[model samples]
Target: MARVDLNDYVYVNARVRGMRSHLLTRDFFMRLVEADGFEALHALLEQTIYRREANEAFLLNPVRPDYDQALTLNLIAAFRKILDAVGGEPRRLVATLLSRYDVQNIKSVLRGKHGDATASEITNILVPVGSLRLEQLEVLAGQREIRDVINTMHAQQIKYARPLIDAYPDFTKKDHDLAVLELALDKYFYRDAIGQLKGKGTNTEMVRQMLVGEVDMRNISTLVRIRGVRLDDGEVENLRIPGGALSADEFLHLDRLGDIVRIVSDYPDPRYRKVLQKALAEYQEVDLVAFDRELEHEMTRRGAAMSNLDVLSIGVIIGFMWQKNNEVINLRILLRGKAMDRPQAQIRSDLFFVEREEGQAA
Candidate 1:
């Protein structure tokens, strides 16, 4: 692939900035939390960039299952628009970043296959914004066994297949545990993304830092979540990915989840340390979910700041993508909460909002 030039990103950045402005506001989410049901929430969504999706979902209301599919379609449509707006090497770089969705879709397929999910059920959850097309993922979903899926991926020469194939034995030994396969996929995606961004340019450096931060956050969250499970130190070590701010050994010896906060405090990245502290403070008063939301919001905030610093580079594009993904995530949580009849307070607590600083808010 050709390297992306900073100058080549100018037009795309301007277009993305315009699109970013249309992202749902914090107030809109507050209203969503108070929504009576999917109908009300869908109406609210119709007022935003997701209007078309909301309308389509409403038309499919009798079927209902298509609601989730509509949201996924909207996400892919948004991504496709962004991808279409750029050309050449810049588009390739963006595709590399978006390929994380490919990783996600593959993992969903493997898990569905392992659990004997019907092809329609698996197709409903698969995201098609990455390298793999929807039809290809649907075909993978139709496979009868995890091994068949892996073989198909390999026969098709998919880049992601190599890691899963190498880990297949461990997965089989672990009783087809999807977590093992998932960890392998996550590690490969992060390493592959970092490799692509390596030595590209100053523009790529900004995007690289964002990816590194993501790896660190994932490792930290994994450490916290796995503490409640029965996994031993070695098992935990196997789950950790390299190339983050912290070394694998750093997380291997942690005695408790709180120790992760202290490790974050000592991290070389000051922004991470600050976010960890804030998250820790919130965690004490509320719950671990609060901490997770804080960490995510802080990362998004920093990405936005970086985009502002270098608007005509990959940073802006990456920032917009992060914000776009967050929009979809927050909507999913809200829509699912409504569908499940969850409490307003609980759903509100679970949301990750993108709040502008006091002066910045119009």
Candidate 2:
């Protein structure tokens, strides 16, 4: 871990706080859901942080064929701006967090290659926000096979290539199971990110807590999704990552439980119990999408509280990053829902927002 100067974080923290002000509120998202079509949504986006990217995307694809491309570009650009806003250890820390996007891009390319997707189609899903540049990703995306993609990454000495390389043989032998490959990448990412924060000063605890919270949530969600599947306990254990709040034994026990909602509701962590109950009720009434939205909101809400308590530390930046990412996700949901003519109420229900206490501004 690198030494972080708390004083140095002052400027960046201020900048992040200012940027947080620009994040879309719940009200704004409701308005987006009320939007009649993609054109209206695009117009609404012009009034937000996506103004530039939205314009560029419209210029390139006048028919607005795929809004995901524009959204991905916008998110990448926003992350780059965040990278540029800091220096020294903070920059390195933020870059480390952003590297998850590199992992995501690599996974996308591997999957695309597995499916024999065209370069243009693969590029649409790539988010070029990490150390890897768009050109490098494009080159990798052109690989004819999954092995070639992994080999190229390894040959280039990319940090994320190791796990992919190690998991490649098994993935190939197992009928090219993409889940195996994806699990490898996810495990490696959490391990590496958590390992990097071992000795970082001041901000280490906040970042570690954030990472742990995310891992726990992901493990729970994975367990829920695979409940009725044919996977055995060993396979389920493989999907759970270490370094989360729960121990391996505890997670295994939770996995064996018949009621996921009751398991979460009765868990030691009270922070999420209420949210999980709400999500569970919605799940029973509607579907998993509603439950997912509530769970995400709980996480973001907790992150916001941590950030508020440690405004002078990396918590603020982490909180802002989460909010920014959620904004992009909510916008994508609106665009997709409107495009598909899904009910406005359903779209609005599926969106996650950073919950605010009464009298608190966004």
Query: Highest TM-score: which candidate?
Result: 2
| lDDT per residue (tens digit) for residues 18-112 in model 1 | 88788888888898888776667667777887778768766767446455677788778778878887777787778877888999899889888
Worst 10 residues of 1 by lDDT: 353-362
Q: Where in model 2 is the C-alpha error above 4 Å?
A: 1-7, 36-41, 228-233, 265-271, 357-362
Q: Which residue pairs clash in candidate 1?
A: none
Query: What's the number of clashes in each of the models?
Result: 0, 0
Among residues 3 or more apart in sequence or in different chains, the pairs in candidate 2 whose N, CA or C atoms overlap within 3 Å are none
TM-score of each model, in listed order: 0.86, 0.89
